[model samples]
Target: MGNQRTTTLEARVSLAQDPATTPATLYELCSDPSPEVRAAVAARPEAPAEALRPLTRDRDRTVREAVARNPSSSQANLLRLVGDADRWVRWAVAANPAVDTRIRQQMVKAQDKELRGLLAEMPDLEPDLAAVLIRDVSPEVRERLAAHTEDLDVITALLADRTVRVRKGLAINQRTTAEHRHALAGDSSPDVRAALVRALELDEADLQALVHDRSVEVRRSLATSAVTPQHIRRALESDPDETVAEDARGYQAAGEPRTAHRRPIGKRFPGRRGR
Candidate 1:
């Protein structure tokens, strides 16, 4: 029996290497006692769904994982592996492009927060489903959603989320819109406020308002905001915080030098003129 299994494994490997090997040849090898032969059959592009289906139930997790990774496996086969005992097998299902939106939605709603978070980061994840993840009970899941989805409304909603960490994600999202920016600008947390100030592209009026914010850090940020207008400079000049005022003065001074009238050389030399 040992020699027969070894011979079968070697024959499967040889058949797998031949592009012209028939599906029947590969299918027979898939049932070989050796997991290595089964893995080889699982990887064959021409291996039929029927042949691959049995491997989904293979006793060896490694062989099952290889079956899950195979593009040749039917969607049904992949879905069956979605709840495999091994997390890596489920991860392979999540990573499969052929996994349909319905399956993805189910996975996104999984009881496992880790799986939900992983689904949130998939590039082709449906936007509406991603939006749902924005409200997931787990902060880590919501954080992943905020980091991945580009939907303006979704991000806008996340910006107002009670969780400061979620709001922080919104503040940093590049797709954040003007409305989102305005909302984050009013966030109570200074860290969230600072993140908004750094990431948002506020207009002059908005920038000027932030410059006068009660928080010294917010005011300090506006003093250096590239969008800070000439009028903002005047506003900061009168700011109560001396640091803010100094920054404003430096900004103004860099753009417009202080003029000092020098005594004209000709005026000083008038007595020597036209000798």
Candidate 2:
């Protein structure tokens, strides 16, 4: 009896893998007794919608995940799997690169915060969604958006965000205008201003003002940052705070030339730049 089961499994595997297997045959195998056979069909990018659609609701979780990950899966079926009871299945749908804006909009309403966060990280995120996610309860999502989004409205809104992390992210964003830098230069949090100092150039007026900033941390940040302009570093050498002055002198002595223009490092979301 065991030998018969093994022989049947081998035949199912062979049928599933055969290059000439017809869609009709794969569709027939979709309901095969072996979960492995069904999963194999589900993973095939060429599998017909008819075959992949039913696998989206397969009893086996792995089969459902396979369908969710298949780029060729119908949008309708992918949307159905987005709401799958299992979080892993939902994650597969979220991570599929072929997911459309409509799916992303739907994901914004999902109960899972991580799904919402993944949507927030999309470089091509629609402006309407940016307006909504700006108010997301998760600060991390807001922080990620602040660092990468180029939407003017969203950037303006984040300037008022009470979270220090969000403000800090805005401070370093390449999209921040000179006016934005002026506003951040006077930010209440020393850390926020410190992050701003990492930008290659600051409005001359803002740079002069930051030279005398009350917080030593902000001055020290400007003093030690590789991107700080030469003039700013020179002024810091005379800072009232001796430690700030020492840091400025030490950094200058190292002889690393500052960039002539702004070169924002890590300013854009990964894999989304130049889009």
Candidate 3:
């Protein structure tokens, strides 16, 4: 019996590597006694959903993890795997886009810190689930929600969070509002201030303020913003950091003259540079 199982496992492994192997053959291998056979079948892109589902309960956690990673795994299977005993298995389920909002919400509510952490890191989490995760007990979960959710209210709320990492995530979120941007401008943490500067879609006046921020990192990010005004550029021209100042100078130079003598460099520069 041992020799027969070994031979069966080896045959399945060989079939798993062959491009011409049929899905049916791969599915059969998914139930083989050897975990190695199950893992090999799970790794095949052509492996069917039936094959993946059974492996979710495989005695070997490694084989179960392979099933969790399979792109072909059904949403039902993924939902079940989200509560798997193994941390890595739950993490893999969270990473799967097919897992539904209900499962994500359940994972967010889990008592297991590691499971909650994995759910928080999932970028495709529903907007509502993300909002809830932003208030999770785990700071790591809140930070992940802050980093990925594009919803304005959720991000705004995160901006006021005591956790520096959560605030930093909001400061860099693209959907961040001008109100949030203004708030972050005064943040005590330099990292949050710098990320805020990068995230802010500011007008001329706000850009000017950022360029003059006490934090050199904030000023450096402002100089690199594509929407930075020419007046802001000129203001940063003498900035202490030559690299940042040079970027501002480049913006200024690009705007300088398609038609220079039309107006002085000073007057025309600001209006033209933003375009």
- For candidate 3, the lDDT comes to 0.73
Model 3, which residues run further than 4 Å from truth? 1-10, 16-28, 31-33, 44-50, 112-114, 121-124, 220-233, 239-275
What would the per-residue lDDT of candidate 1 be over residues 187-227, giving only the tens digit for each residue? 88877776666666775556756876889887776776665
Q: List the residue pairs that clash in candidate 2.
A: none
Model 1 spans with C-alpha error above 4 angstroms: 1-4, 8-11, 194-275
Q: 122-148, model 3: which lDDT tens digit per residue?
A: 765677777678778878778777776
At residue 171, candidate 1 shows an lDDT of: 68
Distance from true position, residue 258, model 2, in Å?
A: 16
Write the number of the candidate with greater lDDT, choosing between 1 and 3: 1
Pairs with backbone N, CA or C atoms under 3 Å apart (clashes), candidate 3: none
Give, for candidate 3, the lowest lDDT window spanning 10 residues.
258-267
For each candidate, give its TM-score against the true structure: 0.68, 0.76, 0.72
248 Cα displacement, candidate 1 (Å):
14
Over 141-187, each residue of candidate 2 has an lDDT whose tens digit, in order, gives 88888988888778899999999999998998888888888899999
